[model samples]
Target chain A: MRVCVLNGFDSEEMTVAQERKLEQELEVLNQKGDTVDYFKLRDRKIAYCLGCWDCWLKTPGECRIKDEQEDILKSFVKTDHLVFVSNVRLGFVTATLKKTMDRLIPNFLPYIRVYQNEFHHYPRYEKTPILHTRLIVDHTVERDEIDLIEDYFKRVALNFGSDLKSFKIIDGKGEEDYEFADM
Target chain B: MLICNGSPRGEMSNSATIAKWFLKDQDKVILLMKGPKHQEYLDILAAYDHIVFIYPLYVDAMPGIVKAFFERVAIADGLMAGKKVSFIIHSGFPESVHLEVLERYHRILSKKLGFVLADTIVIPGSEGFRLMPPKQNRKKQQDVMKLMDQFRIDQPFDDHLVRRLAGKRQSNKMRNFIFSLLEKTGITNLYWNSNLKRNNAYNKRFDKPYTEL
Candidate 1:
């Protein structure tokens, strides 16, 4: 399966240890023979989506603003599974990850078609196996907090018509205990 | 002003405890609990002059509700143009590493709406403030009040000072050891910790307390 991991951690000056741990996790996933593609949201300049409905009304399958987000969304369409890793901020996903999810709205837009007697708009993904992982640093969150966030993730996965295979809460205590290491 | 109480516990939140003091005597104070009414609150935010966001840090970042609120507002840019923005972020974690997350959102809001970003006031969570009684929380509350006075005086927020105070000194080996212990225990319930225990134990409502500027 082709797996794409979109990381929303800001990496401007990540410590050497942090970088290596992330790379090692990705390497392990890649070695599993799953063609894993990684995209860092912090590396790109992604603007918030303007609720102009332009993507739906005027431009088909495209956001109004011309940016790197469009290409990233397109890539998600081609991938078999998508893994979104975000450092939990406050008590939820980071703004970068949230913006990325907001920009992906175009991908799920219904393409109108005549099914039987009346014209019906069918969503792009009738059923797709999409595995999502939310790796929050252990030091940053307590165990009770994970349940609430996992519930939100489940809802998000359901909204996208994908099966949420697992929710991995990684306590960034060390490389050894990293959830991705076990994977 | 739009004041977002970003604690999951709603009214019984430490951030709200501090915010009430800062906003007392003000005519307009909109309290937004992190849930369904958020969109309704955003619509109302357009009419406000100053936007004060009071949130607790979750995983070194703003809570999901805050992010969702921003997404909703950012989509409709100019909803808060020419408005002053300030923040009172509370976090159990020591370092202000989480402040960068707020800074990023501030930049996004500033770029989109052309608003004046006011100084942000961040309070470190007390050792047991979340679970401590108001009387017990007096010292931390006083500290927050002092910060508010400085905020009203237009004192520039010194990021360097904040960073120095909140810097993490743990070695990678220590981090690794902790991670290994959690993994070995097969404890998927890693989110449950001493912080929550404290937060649940002492979270309460009290009269707003602030220093007059």
Candidate 2:
């Protein structure tokens, strides 16, 4: 299975111990033989979606802005499963991740379609991947915050026509507590 | 009242039109357009009795700029305890349920920030206003005035008005059938087709630029 991980937390903010745990999680995925790709948002330059609708009516399926996100978007769309790893800062995903979500407008056509009793922009591509949200939690996070993030992703799942597989919180603890579920 | 325009388009947004009409006297309302600058907003957040947020929904969530503002609020730089915060969220899709989750989230945030949630007004099919003429906005303007009259007295919007503004969530079977006929006639997509043709992108309207490498 193809897996893509989007890391929204700044690298400078992560401690070495947390980094080791993240590496262990990746090693587990690697040992399972799943094709894995990790995208650290800090390394790339991403622009906000201007809502121009050019990708819709003009250059269909492609954003006009020149940025590193073009390739990242490709991997995000083609993967079999998608993972969002972000430390809870303001009770949800970081602004970096939110900007990437805004830039994902190209994934859908401007044309509207009715699905599940609601109107949604039709997909530009045919396939939909499974979504997994792994939040890096801090002491500030409450049960309601976690549930709200999960609920938000369920909305994301519905929009992308993807199945919401799971939502988990990963603390600074060692990777021994983490296990790669069989895909 | 402070009116914060959270649309990515900033000033030239459909939400701006809604905001303009929603006000009884434009002078008393302060319009703050969301920009890259965040620190400027922090000082002004506490001074107002009421703050109105007008934004377009992106991917079933707040736009990145507005989300950043929410993050600022979450950080607790100011006291939001006594202020009344209201939202006027509009979306491209014609579904009230699509914005329902965010409304709940807003309610949660309201509680967390200790602000009074005035009302969460979700306007589905808001994008349609762009395609129509200026004359069509009069009714919405009047509706906005009536809402303000109620808000001035510290009252919430009537349920019937909210239902009316939200429009139909799902197109009924009969309407869907009629729309199919309209689609065949090219009337349903006339707005999009005309805009595409105006920009000389009509031929490439369905072009898929991204291919699997």
Per-prediction fnat values?
A: 0.04, 0.51
* TM-score, per-candidate, Cα-based: 0.46, 0.89
Docking quality (DockQ) of candidate 1: 0.04
User: Given candidate 1, what's the lDDT at residue B14?
Assistant: 69
Interface RMSD of 2: 2.0
Highest-lDDT candidate:
2
Interface RMSD of each: 23.2, 2.0
Cα displacement (Å) at residue A76, model 1 = 0.9
Q: Which lDDT values do the candidates have, in the order given?
A: 0.57, 0.74
Docking class for candidate 1 = incorrect
Q: lDDT tens digits, residues A54-99, model 2?
A: 8877777778888978877788777898887677666667777888
Chain A: TM-score in each model: 0.80, 0.90
